[model samples]
Every structure is written in structure tokens, then in C-alpha cells.
Target: MTAPITMFGPDFPFAYDDFLSHRAGLGAVPAAAHGTEIAIIGAGIAGIVAGHELMKLGLKPVLFESDRIGGRLRSEPFKDGAGAYAELGAMRFPPSSRALFHYFDKVGIETIGFPNPLAPDTPSTVIELGGVKHYARTKDDLPKRFAEVERAWAEALEEGAHYGELTAAIRARDVATIKRLWHHLVESLDEESFSGFIANSKAFRELGFRAREMFGQVGFGTGGWDTDFPNSILEILRVVATGADDEHRLVVGGVEQLPRRLWALVPEVMAHWPSGTSLASLHNHVPKPGVAKIAPGTTKKFAITDRYGTTTEYDAVIVTCQVWLLSARIDCSESLFHHDLWMAMERTHYMQSSKTFVMVDRPFWRDVDPATGEHALSMTLSDRLTRGTYLLDNGEDKPGVICLSYTWSDDALKWLALPLDDRVRLMLHSLRQIYPTLDIAQHIIGAPITVSWESDPNFMGAFKANLPGHYRYQRRLFSHFVQDDLPEPHRGIFLAGDDISWTAGWAEGAVTTALNAVAGIIRHLGGTAHPENPDPIDRWSDLAPVRLVE
Candidate 1:
């Protein structure tokens, strides 16, 4: 028998019965005539943004989602009297995502800088390496971090040059250099594990210890290993550096409020508004029109199911699910989109991460850092005992609530594979690293709640990673709808999500991709659309390498 669903805290905010009833109500809406302007699959931030943009252009968009509207941006209420909510999936936005910030502003959402609890001016971060605690104040204080990172970049540059030299011999366009370097990066990453890649490099070893320090200081997770390009570490570094200045923040009420506000902006044009819909399978063809077969016995008029157990039909479908899930449902024969792209996407790996909100009768950490008082956000690289724990202060209610987020790499996943009690013990043990004095047994009022994105069938991972050999394919996939082989209004389906652009794995990326997609769609609709300038990092030149004689 399947494992029973464990309820550690109060029930989900929305009543299960209410959610089901809402789903059922959707089926009652009469089906409109075939061939709408657009059909958006996945009502996550990407789909929501796209739908809103389409409405502004006077076009109607039918939004579809298999589960919740927020996608990974989900938050749930804490059971204890914290009077606060904890993020089950994604949290925080990078400051660089100006487009996303504008969207939130337009919707009247406000964000506050994360309040640091440990040290207001400069937070104290520690990394637990092989069960030992190493502390650092500023990012630069981390030993050997810069040297190791520089060495890795040097190696990557050398590899790129070698590859570029060969490609340039055949053709001289900047495209050749970009493609060659891109190919080299992806191949190198795919050939070995990220750890293995560093170990094998003599230059990397010289810098590896320092590299770890740098990553630890900056709170870089193993998730960093998954990228769209393997060969260009420099590119990834640039994106990371650019995003570092951005502070993590939340909308006054909740991040979900952002999507709800967007929907309110254009309710009439959105499909299944204030409701829900499910997509069965999508049909993609070049010359002829594509169809999305809906399932029968659907809960609402928007509900769809078909004979092969598929349902829902649309003139155009924009899929925003993880690349892997999209690959499974795609009809390869009819899709002009390359199959190699799908294969490369499957090879990318995602780390299993978990976030838990502990509701204590008091803001325990506040006492630990008395100077800052109770309302401060402190981000830590390591807990005395736990790996990957970051502390966030939820500025709501006294005996304030702090959300402790624990992220695990492959090693932690192995520990998670253990029995439930063992996992709980492990979590508590890790908590001791941060608070050695507090008796977790006594202070804990109730069972802790955990959300594992990796374990979710629908998600399977937190977000898309740009692993080695994957960049080219990722770029192509992001631009698929805009390619010439597709029908008029060729950019009919724009891919939006964290994985689509440089801001991949971020909310900003989702918004940026949505903006780009919307612009394309508007242009196709005969509306004037102007392209924005390339990202600042896109203008950077490859750093010249230093040569050493052995």
C-alpha cells in the first residue's frame, strides 16, 4: 500500500473540499469555438505573465495548469501562532529582475529587504566541511576561494580557445566562437561530476579549496552545477556576480499575491479564471495547426481528457513545466523542435532540497543575536550541526516566527532515503549546530513540516539547471516558438520559466522571458514591438588568460 500522507501541521490553508469543488465548477463552462489566439499550459508565473501580456494586446489566452497556479512559488501557513507563512518551494527575488519588480509594482505589491538577524551590517556565515565549522565574515575572507575560481575560469578559457580556434578556422563569425565555446563547455561538464571536474584539474586543485570557500561564503549550492552551458564557467560567474547585489524579499502578504494580482489585471481574457484546468497532451506540427486534446470526465468545462487518456485542444500551446515533463508529453514526430534538445535536458540533474518552518513560542535566534533584537534576517552558510540551513525572520507577531530553510545536495538525499524518524533526528541534530543550548525536544511544540520539491512527481526537482553540453539546446528551446519553421504568428508559443534565460532558476528570469515572449507575440499580432538591449553580461568579453611555463 502507498504510504499514508503525513500531516505534521494544520491542514493546507485552502480547504481540500473547497479546492475540489472549485475544480469541478470549471467543467461547467461551455467550450468555445476551436482556434483561440493562444493556449498557455502551466499557470505558473511564466504562464500568468504571458496571459496578462496577451490580454493587453487585445488577444485572449486560455491558461491551463495541472496543479496550483504559482508553480514553485507556493507558501503555506505555519501551524503555531507565528501568524506567518513559510515557502514550500521558491522564495525571494533577485534585485536585478527589474521587469519583475515593475510587474509587482504595477500590481501594487511591495517588497522589503531581508532583515539580517545574526549581524545587521555584515552577517556571519559558516560552512560545515566534513563535519567541521569554518566561519567567514565578508565573501573575500573565505580562504583560497578566489584563486580556485580564477583557475577554473582559466582552464575553461583555455578549453574554449582550443575549441574556438578549430571552429573559427571553418568560419569567422562571432557565432562560430560562441557556438564552439558553448559546445566545449557543455561536453566538459557532462563528461564528469562537478566535484570530479574540480578534482581532475591541477589548476582547479590549486584553487579548489578556495573555490569551496568562495561558494560557501556566497551560499552557492550544488544546484550551481546544473547549468545550460558546461564550457563557459565565466558566463555563469558573471550572472552570479550580477545577481549577488540583489536582496531577497517577499511581497507584503505572500508571493502568491503577485500572480493573483496579475490575474485580476486581466480576468476576462484568462481561461479558467478564478478556476483551474488540466492539459492532457499537445500536438505540434509545422504546416498544419497543432491541437491539445483535453480529457473527458474533466471536473469543469475547461477540464479535458481524451481517449488515449488525453484531452484539451488549443490553436497554440505554451508549455512551462520542467523540461523533462515537457519531453514526455511532446509528440516527437510532429514537433519541429529538435529531439536532441530533449535528450540533453534529460541528462541535467537537480538537487533535492527541503524547507521547513519552525514555529517557536519565541524568536529563539533573536536571543542569540541580542544586538539586532528580534526582527532580523540572518543567512548562514552552515549550522554547527546541519548542512545548508539559512535563517529568515518572518516579521510577524511576537515570540516572532523564523523560517529555517534546509537545502540538501546528493549526500543529504542519501540521508533522506532513511526512515522517517531517522530523518527527523537528523534534522534536529543539524538544528543543534545553530542552537547548541536550546533543547529541541522541549522547545518544539509540535511536529515540524517539510516540503521536498525533488520528491514531488509533478516537479521532480526544484528548477532547471544548465548542465554541460546543454546550453545550445537550452537556447534553441527558449527560442523555439520564434523560429521560422513554425506557422505565421510563428512566435505563437513563447517559453517562460526560470530556465529560459540568463536569470535561469530565478523569478526574474521567468518575468524576463515572459516579457520577451509577450513582445514577440505582440509583434506578430501587428502591434509595434521593440527589442530591449542585451543583458550587461552579454556584452562582456572573455577574460584573457595568463600563461605559465612549466
Candidate 2:
């Protein structure tokens, strides 16, 4: 049997899963540094994971949040009290996220197959484009033109990126082969956009214009690559190469539970802290107020000021929030980071995302329509304004939720100015075009919930999507965790979160990067990782992302 492909990095192939599962634990700090306080800015999965690990290493992790915790793993609950909720932020997670699953297992969170378009368990799928609607249970049910686009995509990957060999190497954890193949691709394709890659590929060229449009509208794995067309081809390839876009599962209640649970979990085995101690107990079950300012203090410490005008100094700081907030919302000192690092943070392009969800009486979509002998509604992928619609079935007896519209980038921007009622009406209008007989509004139980990440002051955008020629910028950010090559003034602060990872927008990236921050902190405060369970920094020399010449 072929080894399962995981998010083991075509960029940095360190095994974070192994490190987390190891019995030796993530090393310890010196006796003097044991009780050192480390400020973690942001209460998202990244911040929480970093704090949890840091706490285990006999360090005090102070978490600061501007808004609600869990960041993008937002699970907004309905008043019905039946455990139904709208996943306003991250909804699906791929199984390749081994490191993230470690926390899920630790927290006792369960997962079920996500209702992605064309997924096996998804009752059915509706692919509508250019005023044409095609209902399909699988790819074979779609017209031959879609098959051509699918074939074109496969051929394009194999031809342009050596997809087969690279994926094989990734599955086997053959770091040498992965680095060799990926480095060459990055050097050659870093400047190419996803659309440019498809347009220039021989397979796509043969298929012509409409085929390319189809591929963009209803992409492989998840759905729709049109919004991502402007991003670097390397970004798309990383998703495909590492199986980051395949076999996705939804967390059983909501993904937010992962971070929340981690915050409250008390490890049975810990270093300095007692067995019963937890992050919540340490902070009195509440995080500090939002950060107002961050500046360098005496003796290489960081001075953090909260919104309530309280100031405190810490030995080190881990910033897990969106890097854009550094300039947008916070008063940060210029001397804290190098100019090149600032340039990288500024250049990091974030994609806007909007999701509008409504709770229905039950899984009404499963009802059969007499006239057509088909289900009333299905998981939808479309070119219309309501780009993708998903049906979240809780159970036959419980209320079901429908993500009326889930859009990214331009589509999300279109909904940014619209009010909740207007947004719902517009999305329902678009869905009406697809399902004329389905009375969706009649089944809606409660008020709809919606969010546009770009509109929120706390999160400027949903997640990072590297633009063409952004490899250098991303390299600078991802490598900041290993600060050996950095200047004295910039040495202590570490940048983490999915945005700082090569594979952004995935929870695995968030968890792995948080682990990176943990390792960085351990080393910075006079600690070392166990030789048997070497952390990311320990293996940085051999597996660091390839840096391109300017």
C-alpha cells in the first residue's frame, strides 16, 4: 500500500506530528528561565497551541486578545440550543493535518466527513456555470467537458510540476527528493500566477478558453480556483502536492472547540506546573485585555500595554495574530523588527472570505422532489454571486445549517458593503436561479449569521495567499522562527500563525507554526529540544525553505 500523503512539507519537511507525540516532550528551559513570562499576542489556535506547549515547558504564557478567542476557527452558535452552529471561519480540515489532529485527539474533538462538492458522502452536488446547471453525484455524472478540464488539470500538474513524483516523495517523507524537486519548481514558478500556469500549460492550451473557465469555477478537491488564480502557482501546487486539499473533515460541533479545549486542558504530565494546572486556572479563566502597544524594554524584554492602560514586561513575546495588525491596529515600535521583515509582512497578501449561514428546521434538503425524482437541494458550486453553498446536516432529528454562500477574494468583497438582510436576499436570489422549486427561506428557522473577515478590524483578511514573486517575502517570514541569522534587536520576538506558514489557510499550518514558535521560545530562553524528539528549529539547517536570490 502507498504511504498516505500528509502536510509534511514540500517546503519544510520536519515531522511536527512525531515531535508532538514523542514521550520525551518538547525540552525544558534552564532553572532560572523556568518561571519566565512570555507574552502571546492573539488567542487564536496559533496562540493557544503555543501557550499550551510553552506552559508544559515550565514557562508562563500570557495570552492577549483583541476580540474573541479561536480567531478564524469561529463557531457561532444558534439560540435553538440543539448544538447547531455556523462555522463562520474555518469549516473544513484535511486529514493530512497530522499535527493538528494531535491536538484534536488531545482535546477529545471528533470529526465527520465534510460535505464538499463531489465528496462521496455529500448526498449530491450541483455545478452551475454560465447559466448552465449540472447535477452530479460524482465527476462521471458531469458532462465530458468537465472531464476534459479535470484531465487538463491533471496533465498540467504532471507536465508543469512533476506532480506524481513530488507527491510520491512527500508521502514517503523523502526530504531530499522533495527539496530537490520543490526548490527547482519554486525557482522557476515563483513568479507565475495560478492562471498563468494553467494558460501556459500545454494541456490547458489544447482544451482552450471555456475549459479553463470551467476549471476555475469548479476546481479540484474543494471548489473554485478562480479567486486563487491571482495567487502564486507555487501556493496551489503546495496544496495539491501535499494533499492539503483532499479528504477534508469537519469538526463535530465546531473547530473553535479545539483552541478553547486546549486553553482549559491540564496535561497529566508536565514539568514545573502541577498536574491539575491549566491555562485557564493560571489566568483566572479570562485572557488579558487587547494589546494597545508593543515596544522593546530594558534587558531584551518586551513591554506590552493592554487596552485598559495596564503595562507589563515579559521575557519574550510570540505574535500569532495576522501580521497586518502590526501596522493597522497596534502601536508597535519600528526597531522591534528588521526593515526586510517589515517589508515581508507588508507584502503578505491576505484573501478576503465571506460566509453566510442559516439554520433550517431539519435536513430538509434530503427530501425528494416528485417532479424531477431528485433531492430538493445539494452542495452547490456556481459562477453566480453565491459561489458555493453547503448543507450542514446535524442529524435527522436536529436542526440543519446551510452555508448559503461561501466566497473568497472578489466575491467576498462584493458582499462587504451589504447588510445581513440584503446579503441573505441576494444569496437566496442566486440560489433561486439554481433551485427554482426549492423554498429555502420557508425552512429557515432563525435569523441568518454572516461575516466578512476583511470588514473586521481585528482580522484584516481571512488568510494569506502568496502573490506571484512572493516566495522571498514568505521565506523571510517563515524563517524568522530560527533567529540565529537575525540582528540583536530583532532576535527575541517570533512571528507565528498560519499566515507565517508556507501552507497558509490550513489549520495544520497554524498548529505546526505554533510549534515552531514554541521551539523558538524554548531555545531563546536557554532551553534545548530533546535529541530524540527534535523540534522544527532543531532540523532547520537541513529542511529550511529554499531562499531565492533577489
Best by TM-score: 2
TM-score, cand. 1 = 0.66
Write down the lDDT that model 1 would get: 0.48
* Estimated TM-score for each candidate: 0.66, 0.99
Q: Per-residue CA lDDT of candidate 2, range 1-550, in tens? A: 9899899998999988888999899888997887788999999999999999999888889999988889999999988748999999888988899999999999899999999999977999999998899998888889998888989999999999999999999999999999999999999999999999999999999989888888999997799999999999999998988888899999998999999999999988777887798999888999998998999886647899999999898889999999999998999999999999899999999999999999999999898878786789999999999999999999999999999999999999999999999999999999999989778999988889999999999999999999999999999999999998888888789999999999899988988889999989988988999988888888988998888998
Give the Å error, residue 457, model 2: 0.5
Minimum summed lDDT over a 10-residue window in model 1 is located at: 6-15
